[model samples]
Target chain A: MEATVKIFRFNPETDQKPHFETYTMPVESTDRVLDLLEYIKGNFDGTLSFRRSCAHGICGSDAMRINGRNYLACKALVKDVGLKIKVEPVLGLKVIKDLIVDMDPFFEHFRSVMPYFVNDEPPPAKERLQTIEERERFDDTTKCILCACCTTSCPSFWANQEYLGPAAMVNAHRFIFDSRDRAAAERLRILNDQFGVFRCHTIFNCTIACPREIEITQAIGELKNAISTGALE
Target chain B: MMQTRVVPQRGFNLDYIMFIFTRVSGLSIVLLALVGIILAMVMGARTQMDLGTLMRWTFFPNPNHVVNSDIPDVTLGWANAYWSTMQFLLIFFAFTHAANGLRMIVEDYVNRGVGQLLVRGFFFLLWLFMLITAIFVVLSS
Candidate 1:
């Protein structure tokens, strides 16, 4: 089947404004959207640029708006998005070039959440351990690839870029709920600010837009629950 | 693993206050509406008032408030008996009703990149305007 891929193009140095350039090419039903992008870049226009590390969707370097929804290009197949495809850079971020967004703000929010283990205690004789149930408590949030898909799709983030976004909260949730981590209090303090979990508004766009299918809204609700009730359960 | 049973409590902030306020306000609204409906029913609304009058009574309960004199000598109406309750109800409930309803619609339809920032800014100002105006009206009256 022939697929028409319209790519959002912009170069700050050259183009006065952003525009879309369309390419028609043959594609199989099983071919990934990344394949279509590669075809366009390889044959149609070498100047076209997009981020993609592992074409298998693990790297999460190619998250974009495909057909008005956030999805990983390498994960979305041609048949799923139909023949006529419209691709654009993810929303709520500064676009550097064609299909490339500045992810500094996103990473900054992630870092602010302290998305790491912080158990300041005498080193256990050997290593710390966790129960299966405790691990399962926050298992869902462990799959975040830092794609910014969920964060970019959030309307709250679009409205207020400082809202920390869903991806950061999910990363926070991962460590906050961990029975092995002791920084939950500090993280909760940060999240209690104006740009924290309270800004979520329960929109659920982050949950739907997540390519990994992580229950982003549920994780946020859990974070809110922990803050409100002061109980991790 | 660290002893992680309960996390820290949330500190005070407008957002946190409003977060809890939103939940409590929702329940208060239902309770207030129930009180209004029951009082209206008990006040012989079934026998004397039509469904429209009962609904108006349930909502504002001050059927003649719109036309009532600002400097009336004495409170003289079925709703006047419950004046204080109706006063508090009319102030906060109405504000939350309209503001939260608008928030729901805006959050539902105008989500994502399109019109998000514009709608959010517009709603915030509208809420602030409504709050200040309501306070002024209450204080002046």
Candidate 2:
């Protein structure tokens, strides 16, 4: 199949404004959008830049706006996006180059949630034990790969980066509902600030844009419920 | 399946409080409208007034709205202190609910710094002014 791909281009050192560069190439129906990018970068312009590690969607590095929606380039099939595909960097973040965005602020918000486990008591003989039901309470949010797809697609996060976006809330839900963690209240306090979980308008954009199929809006709702009713079960 | 792992409850800030208040006040406004309709029908509105008059009283519940309608007398049923209180309550809920909603929208963009302060101050005064004027009209008329 013949595909016309328009990839956003930017070079801070060379150009004052960002622009788009189109590539017309023949690709198989099974060829993914990432394959098109790789082909373009190899044969067309060597200066094009993007981030892709593992190329299998596990690393969450190839997230970008594909046809106005957030998706992993490796996972987006050329056949699914039709003959014409428009790819750009994710929204609401600074594009350092073509498709590579500055991810430091995103990671900063993720780290603010205290994503690690916090149990101050002495260790058990082997590992912390948990029931199946307890594990299922937060099983959905554990699939988040910090891809920023959900956060960048959120209107609230786009308006204000200070607000703790949906990704951070999902990470908070993971630990806050764990049966072995003891710092749920501390994490709740951190999220109870002005720019916390309440910032979410429950528009479901984050839920729809998640490539891992994580129930991000529902996770944020659970955080709001926990903050209001103080219930983990 | 219960609050086995409980989050410590603390006094929530204005945002969470307003989030819950928006829901409660929204329901309260609906209930108030229903109450107004019931009272209007009970006082012979169904027989004595048209649909426009009945609908007008359903929201405002004032004598001025019904005075020029098919209803002959407006001294006792629709023009008393009780109806004035209802009008005040309706305006209060609707205004406060909408004002807080405006703040929620503003918080989406301006959560910090001078812009936040300016929007907060400006919208608050606007809400206050509108509310006071509504209250005066409700009581005087």
Candidate 3:
């Protein structure tokens, strides 16, 4: 099938303003959008820039706005997007180049949530033990690959950049619900900031945009319930 | 990443509950107000009643007058009961929605610390006072 890909192009050093460029190429029905991008870069425009690692969906490095929604480039099939695909860098981030968004802000929020476990007790004689039930509590959120798809799709983040976006909240939910984690109270307190979990309006955009299929909104709701009922403490 | 220090557990923060209540009350106000307005408009059109009469009916619902009027007493009583219930709900939803909205705005824009707490507390107390006053007036009428 023939596909016309419209890509947003800009180089801060050379371009006065950003613009779109169209490239028509033959693509197989099974070809993913990332494959088409690779063909464009290799054959038509070597200057085109995008981020991709592992060429699979796991790395989550190639998340961008495809046809006005955030998706992992490697995961979206060209056939599914129709003949004309409009691509751009994800919203609410600094666009370094075509289809590439600076992820520093997203990662900064993730870090602020204290993504790692903090157990004050001395290390057990062996690894910490958890029952299967306890492990299942937060298993869903562990699938997040640090992709900014959910955060970028969030309207709350666009309105107030200071708000800890849904992605960070998901990560916090992962740790806060863990039975062995001792920092649940501290994590909850940190999230009690004015820009924290309460900012989410249950819009479900993050839940839809998540590539990992994690129930991001449900996790945030759990956090809200915990905070309201004092269950986390 | 810096390790987070465990803070002393403070039981039952009302902020989240207040937030949820504000949202629910706001939605209820919108839906209830819409129904009330539509019902009023339909009744006014059917009865050929002007806005003045409608306003008077809303502010002063007299069950005794309805009972003695030519209209069936049972029907008029039902109507009066409905009107009183609607009025009470409108007062409750309106007060809670506005008060909660003000609290949210203050918390979002104001500085975080004792100042925000004081302002929110003041708003809560004011809301309670206004709600009590409104209920008293509604019951007396």
Candidate 4:
């Protein structure tokens, strides 16, 4: 199948403004968008830059706008994108180069949630134990791979960059609902700010954009309910 | 790189407060509008009134129209009270919901920072103007 891939290209050092460049390539129906990008770089233009690790979509890199939807390029098959693929860097982030965005803002939000287990209780002899039910509590949110897809796709985050984006909230949900985590109170307090969980308006764009198929809106609703019902410490 | 730090405000978080208010006000508007429509329909049917007559009766209730009938007077009084209260609430919710919705739309197109703040401020001013005008109109009537 012959596919026309239109990608946004910009280099801050050389170009004053970003522009789109189209490349035509022979692609197999099974070929991922990432494969098309690679073909463009290797044969058409080496300057075309995009991030990709673990071409199977596990790395969460190579997330871009494919046909107006946020998706990991490695996971979006060429056949699904059809004859014309309009690829651009994810929205609401500074583009560093062609299809490459500065991920610091994304990571900053992720870090704000302290995406890690925290329990000050004296360690059990070996490791913390959790029942299957307890583990299932946050099983959905545990699938997040730090991809900016959900956050970038969110209109709330686009409005207020400070708004703790959906990815951050999902990570917070992971720890907030964990039965063994001791930092639920602190995390809840942190997320209770003006730019915190309250900023979400249930748009569900994040839910739809999620590559992991995580029910982000439902998790956010649970957070709101937890806060209102005083479920947090 | 966008800095991600919490700005600690001393009082209740406005976002949280507004988030709750928007939902509550939305529901209130829907309920009040439904009730208002039904009451209008009932009053219209009672008097065998047309749309223009119903509008006048609703907006400009003539006290003298409630002649000797105790039931008519009581029903008119109740309807007037309900209408006045709903008018006030509808204005408040309509303006608030519109302003908040506009804020979301602006945020999507405008970049975050001073631009967003300025746009939001302009929207706030517009909402305030509309609310005041609506209140004045409602109360005067």
* lDDT (0 to 1) per candidate: 0.83, 0.88, 0.79, 0.80
Backbone clash pairs for candidate 3 read none
Off by over 4 Å in 3: B1-18, B27-92, B95-141
The 10 consecutive residues of candidate 3 chain A with the worst lDDT sum are A224-233
- Candidate maximizing DockQ: 2
Order of the predicted models by TM-score, top scorer first: 2, 1, 4, 3
Over B1-141, each residue of candidate 1 has an lDDT whose tens digit, in order, gives: 334488655687867777777878777777777887897667556666667766665666554532323335322445343544565566676676567657645655575675867887787788778777755544444
List candidate 1 segments past 4 Å from native.
Answer: B1-4, B42-53, B65-77, B81-83, B96-141
Residue pairs whose backbone atoms clash in candidate 2 = none
Taking the tens digit of each residue's C-alpha lDDT, what string does model 1 give over A1-233?
Answer: 79999989999999999999999999899999999999888898998889999888688999999999999999999989999999999999999999999999999999999999998788788889788889899999999999999999998888768789999999999999998889998999999887798888898999998888999999999988888888988
Candidate 3 positional error at B53, Å: 8.8
Query: Tens digits of per-residue lDDT for model 4 on B42-139?
Result: 65535555565454444433332233343444444443555666676777887898898787677667877898899999999999999888667656
Q: What tier of docking accuracy does candidate 3 attain?
A: incorrect
Docking class of 4: incorrect
Off by over 4 Å in 2: B1-3, B37-56, B67-76
Instruction: Decide which is better by lDDT, 1 or 2.
Output: 2
Q: Which consecutive 10 residues in model 4 chain A have the weakest lDDT in total?
A: A224-233
